[model samples]
Target: MQKRAFTLIELLVVIAIIAILAAILFPVFAQAREKARQTSCLSNQKQIGLGVMQYVQDYDETYPTAYYYKNNTATVNGGSAGGYVHMSVLINPYLKNAQVWVCPSDALRGVGPDNPACADWTNITQIGCEAQVPRLSYIPNSSIMPRKRGPQDAPNVVSMAAVDAPADVIAIGEMTDFSNCIFLGSTGQQNNERRNKSHRPVNAIMRTAGGGQWAGQSVADVTGPIFAITQAAAQGAEGWGGPADTRAITNTAGCRGSAADGGLHIRFMSPGRHSGGSNYMFADGHAKWHRFNDTINPNRFLWGRTYFPSGQPVLDQAGVQVR
Candidate 1:
């Protein structure tokens, strides 16, 4: 038999077939990987839910505060100085693992100006006293636990028993860099940043001896209106529509938008961080993957009874009917 070499046409055909197979299979592989991440995220939330329940059982059924001043009466305006204690710090003991503070899909883990990645959460013994707290991939429900202050000028701590429905109350969700925000007023405020876009840097007030010290402009806080409250209390209610396609997603460092200093803002808006939707945990120790488009009934699933009481019409940022 004479040795023969393959013709150029045969090689080209083989290459074309391989390329077509790769094009078809690569997406499937990517989707599979993403699905795994989503599943992991859901499991993390479920564990967090269990931790929360355990915390409630041990602590008289009160949900942990998001972050609070050492002194509750130390108003930011009054120049009262006090450190902040984040919810992660409080919940970590229950979780006993620093890994749960981050989501697998979060790109900004341990990222900041000084740190290349998020700081190791293992040694974070104190929260409010530290200049920067351990960055987390999840955010607490500001409706049940307000960022700056609780409802009616109360502290940002709620009794778990107070919620109308524990199963419907959103405990925590996957948060991105842009998700760490608080609403100050409407879009028309004097210095308020436009909604649904990158918000203006907020002037953070660090803890100082006599009062709150101006820490300079912080990219962590975004001020707007309180949508988590009922329609009657939906002050500055409106949808902040972003013009750009990527505007809805969080920044790479996980610190994309603005953050509140002294936790001075109202509601914590959904970051739309995850693809299609986001993963959230309910107060009743159950986790659910909520699609953004499918969230027509904003009653208990979105925030809770405190924010969306029964019979309230679910509206978008523009005050249009969502359902």
Candidate 2:
């Protein structure tokens, strides 16, 4: 037994070797875990894209509208009246698993009352029908033709065939927290009780650009905290519209003042969890990551013009129509 004793110096060396091995292995393990999560997120997007395609096929090749509004009234079922069905409901049957709605990388998951439930498929009771919850991982192409409004009547729902697809048009991408409402924008009007009404239709698309009574003004207004100049500038130039438009990185000089606070700009610049970069599915149905500061011509990114008013080209970089 005496002969079997390990010297103190030998024991110390062994301990140091084990510590070094653990230090080396721990990072490798963490990297592997992150890689797995990223892969799963990609798979989730792929399935979501397939679901969208299926919905389009059955619904006359139309993409779902992200928001809808009527004569000073939020329609029933939100934007469903405008043929804007939530991508969640449109793709629910195809996904076959509700769990796919919440991405594993999203830290905001399960923070709301609807923990573990798919946010997009269900409406949040607290927000009324006008504010349906979103899945947060995917957004339908906003470039699709919007419903046409008449002089004194509700907007006539236009079919999706009216749209033209551009090469770089975004079809789907990651979004922020589902229930946070930080991105909803201004609701317009003070203490507007009408904003609290339930969606007129059972499956309407909630208006992404409008906030609620307490939030004041249309989501387009510059009064809210999310739309402050500093916040907007920090988000990116015209960070109001899409993933590539977010200010998560590379704030441009052009992004100062109202341009920073503009809803449209904010939407254009919002980023995904990847920070300086985000994933985008093009009109052709292929997905890729785009950097926030990439200076490619904006016209190449225009997916469709049918939704914009005649002669109003979709604005691109430099704030001019690309087409």
Candidate 3:
């Protein structure tokens, strides 16, 4: 038999077909990879939620404070670390696995035991993390977590009994990159005492609006960005997570102003990092994914008021939760 080779036309056709297949399959492959990551993130959320529930049960049904300033003791300021003790530290005894604190899809990967913190100058170093603003880290619901910001005394925690609808309240959410506080959307500064120091506390949009640094403010006029634009436009332009109260998709300066100045909080608004949605751990010890807009729907908003252990609703002055 005589040796034969493919004709140029046939070769060209083969190459073209391969190119077409590559184009068609590349996006699908990418999406599959992303889906896996999202699933992994959800798994992390579920484990964390269960761990938190365990912590609550152990702690007399009280939830952990999201973050609190470490008081300086006689030992040394070096050991005191002069920083806040994060919620991740408080619940680690129950979590057991530090790895679950990180989400696979999290570009920031957030802080782990990789960063240690001091409970106080007298206490030894403990598992904790520290990060600057404009980061995509994990966040606990301030409404439920109760934070002790700055030098003031740690505020009382919201007990499990106070959560009227555990399933409806968001306990922990992924990617705190845009939100400055570890306590997601709780109010502070009751009785002229400053807690969670900054106007940033009120930046969550769905925050309980009562006396605090944001005493007189209102999210009523501040429109939800998803409502301001078409769904297609929002997905393409902002993809969730941006500066506080901003509707302009082009404006990417989420960290432009001081969180105390009340001009920014991009992380809370643009929280969804996985396929235009994010994972959340609900108070009822359930974790799931949700489209960002659905969480913010006024009829059933998930980011607002929880209650004090005394059964008083937070942001009590708002009569109804603000935003």
Best by lDDT: 3
Stretches of model 2 off by over 4 angstroms after superposition: 1-4, 68-85, 110-135, 145-167, 178-276, 295-311, 316-323
241 Cα displacement, candidate 3 (Å): 7.5
Worst 10 residues of 3 by lDDT: 210-219
**Cα-based lDDT for every prediction:** 0.47, 0.40, 0.51
When 1 and 3 are scored with lDDT, the better candidate is 3
Writing each residue's lDDT as its tens digit, candidate 2 over 121-157 gives 3432322222333434554443342322222222333
TM-score of every model?
0.64, 0.57, 0.67
lDDT of 1 by residue, 223-272 (tens): 21122222211111112122111344223222224433333221233434
Backbone clashes for every candidate come to: 23, 40, 11
Name the candidate that leads on TM-score: 3
Task: Report the alpha-carbon TM-score of model 3 versus the true structure.
Answer: 0.67
Tens digits of per-residue lDDT for model 3, 178-228: 323222232321212222222122123322221112111222222211121
Roughly what TM-score does model 1 have, to 2 decimal places? 0.64
True-structure RMSD for candidate 2? 9.0
